[model samples]
Target: MSSLDGTVAAPLSPPRPSSRLPRASDQDGSYPRPQMLRGAWADLDGTWSFRNTGDDPAWRTGFPDARDIVVPFPPESPASGIDEPGFHPVVWYARTITRAELDAAGYGGAAPRLLLHFGAVDHRARVWVDGQFIGEHEGGHTPFTLDVTEALGTDPDTAHTLVVRAEDDPHDVTQPRGKQDWHEHPHAIWYRRTTGIWQTVWLEAVPTASIAGLRWTNVDHATMRLTVRLSGERPAGARVRITARWHEGDEDLATVEAVVPVHAHEVEVVVPVARQQNGQAEDELVWSPETPRLVDAVVSLLPAEGPEPLDAVSSYFGVRTVGVDGGAFLLNGRAYDVRSVLNQGYWPESHLAAPSRQALRREVELIKELGFTAARNHQKIEDPRFLYWADRLGLLVWGEAPGAYAFSPLAVQRLVREWMDAVERDASHPSIVTWVPANESWGVQHVATDPAQQAYARSLADVTRALDPTRPVISNDGWEHTNSDIVTVHDYEGDGARLATTYADDAARTALLGGRGPADRRILVGGAVDEGQPVMLTEFGGVDFQPGAKREDGWGYTSAVDDDDWVARITALYDGVRASAFLAGSCWTQLTDTVQETNGLLNADRTPKVPIERIRAAVTGR
Candidate 1:
């Protein structure tokens, strides 16, 4: 069979030897809502009836004839057990639900509403319960939910059918398809396309009226603002009580509370938090990569005339502020240079989806071990579990959105709304200090010369700031900046000596803008560089192969013939970058080697290619 990208289909090949396989416990059945966790929930992963409908509408009525597929893994990935790879434009998934299962999940309680959550479904998804339509959602990266209590039928004696229909067209450049290749086979830069559910799916039971969402904004080290959004019916005189706990490694610091009336569906409240030991604010307790401190918070709604609180949820926040000063990134009122590595969040067997929560945490641990304070989640929005670990473990992150290749009305519509959704979904986290909407002119390529394209880029930056004022927004990541908080450029100049000269001073910045770098790459587009904004070499030093490593048909900016040569070249590049008089930060080419791209400091399986200590010394200059 030919794929949609005009290539013949073949059986899925085995991954590299370093690839990590999914464990028996890798179903990710844990609580989906890390920000707001509740007690009553059920994991909806495991085997399910799967059928490739391929744009056929007949599969919608009922899926009586379908084979088995493991939940959470797409058909393209080997972990899913169905490794046949031809484009599946439409697919159907079905599973059975029984009264006993509902009762075990606590959905049988009085006034309980059954909520079905899909961590993510590619492109577009339409859901149904017991042959009755429920709802549909667009955007492949964000989560969606449906209330299916009524759809489960009135009779509680019988079982029900849960069905989902997902549609995706990776070849459509108008949609926001990240590194997923539209080609028949994987090629340069772009890898495989993932359709259907690439993330977890589960069910949770909540009260008739519960807290639906939360958004946190750090006003300062002593103050934090929270916007709580409620769901379900709003009774008269409903009040919400918020309690925040400050703990210093099991030693309780203090506890504070705020009671606010919920007149409407959403209400905002300012909570004052102090890091005190002997009645004085301990400035050292503030959050930073060096010392990551978190404050746990619990929220409960109090009805006007009820004995117990209406609803309660568990969440946490960090007290920190991020801003930009003259040519320096500031963290907690001090200039802090960000030493980060570019991580694409890809695995050999799992592709976009991670095999387990441990895998995500291990990546963050490795980044910290390598002496990097932050990571640029290049081109991908990344798994929420990864962000959770970064927040818990104290690693900074630059949140990035995938870019569309072409510019059209549909492309604009797709990128803007989806970017906003992605930002909103991740805004609450303190680890994410910067938001990048476009990267290297992938979606808006004409921003340099075209006025309309420039306007769109500026509009995206404005939208990002409007939604999240606490963090800085990078309009377009690499060169051709329009209205960016940080002036970042990607220059893969392999020669360490010449690379140093390109960013030595403002004169070098001018000369490089006139096509002076390797491959005659243009550093600035339309001669646009805000003199007052902070400058960073967001990408550089893609030293390809290391010593004793078997040479495969791989690609990188430059190749090191031996281990000594690799060390010298990589160290020289870092030396040049750090020696720059104008550079406030630098992001290396990558953290791990992806499929065809072999420019990672670590192998695909998270193992270090070179000596960990040597790489750490070079990166941190310690």
Candidate 2:
């Protein structure tokens, strides 16, 4: 079967679906890590014993009051079956890992290693296997893994007990909480808090020495750089084999093999793509919101004297480049208008945790249905599954880190570490074109004046660039920018005329860019000059309209009386934005109505307030 680009390969079997919208069972029980897929794995996402330990540490031994709760759903959400919205600083979870499950995960091998993986656990997580401490992780949003071969013991008939203790201080202002309200009740922009396990947890079995990490870098139109990181012992005379095939058509792109040097654990290989050769037009295979062409790859670590490989993983990548050229955001060496929406990534039933894997794919479909080319994942590092869907379905994304409320040394340490982790975890995705480390100076509240805070904000951008130079980094998104590739503003002007007047022409735009516009905040600070960076109205058009019932606590930047009124208001706002010659892109206020925020294009149940076509017309200005 041929893909959209008329390419096919053995790995591209079942062919890319022709429909824009995914099937109902598309991602049900699908591999969580689509980028790096292994055949030997187990899905440990069902029922689990849960208990809120409060402030007591005694629950480490055993849960006194245990109840059945759904895995990967926070207790604050109804899907978890422990709908306790109130604060619980510590939570304990217990489950059994049977030998049969290990066997199902292809466990029986010479010197096999059983590995445990957690998608994410809020704040801090400590793990134990049969009363033996395995390891711990600090970041709440990033994934962590541990080799539990010793923890599982040598007994094939044994059923190991796995336990996790997650500690998240609800009132910890220094933590990167994002939209999770520190308050007991949901208020303003903050929503209910997600405590304990909120993402996938699973197990896998591999050889003693395996592929630890894989990074794909698009060097240019034709050249692709592959970085492979090894785990465990670096055996002598081991060679890494990499094979690339066209995702759509049955075509061999590249095949290269490099031997691991003794005492070294990393190797870099260059894969020259056939279609993207210098003579051919690069746009044919380049990835963008319009056409996302991926190259499927199989990487294997082969040992010295054996025909079998020590480890093999399936991965894919797209040939694309993103940068700010002059005053425009360029994708694939061409100017690209970023018509985006603020995606808070919340669901009515699961809070931060997606209700199901299929829901993540549907979210991407819904975003595209609204005629958005991009999504600014506001104040959240969304699940990897969502990013996979975006990559496959051809949607650009702005990766933003959750913000901390206060400024302190600990806050700086926490934000920098977690933000770097978030970037590293998602840097390989072709969909993420930009990195937003700080939003509206959430952690650096005094960045406009305080040199210390300003320095912190600058460091975030600098460090992000250092880690992943492929994408542009926004030091502080919204306003009060210290160092940013794009000048992004957050204007919640209720009047469309006022918004139009504010960014009418060069004089008005220069004045606003030099000084403050809406939100009563500086666009640039710390003696920074506007060097013709691409200007984008990243946040606007938050017109709230509830068709039927409305919550008393629901609020928005502006209110609409009816569906027609809402359509008129948003259409006028989009027109106002389109009138601005200086603005390169615009992101609507939000994609869905979150908790107390009633200014979403869709309702809490993922239903459009008005006809989707009307909203699309308003958004696309067509």
Residues 396-494, model 1: lDDT tens digits = 999998888999998999888888888888888889999999988888766768888888888888999999988988888877777788878888988
lDDT of 2 at 327: 88
Residue 294 lDDT in candidate 2:
75
Top candidate, metric TM-score: 2
Candidate 1, residue 395: CA error in Å? 0.6
Q: What is the C-alpha lDDT of each candidate?
A: 0.78, 0.83
Give lDDT for model 1: 0.78
Model 1 TM-score, all chains together: 0.91
lDDT (10s digit) by residue, model 2, range 188-274: 789999988899998877778888888888787667788888888877888776655563454544333333332468888777665
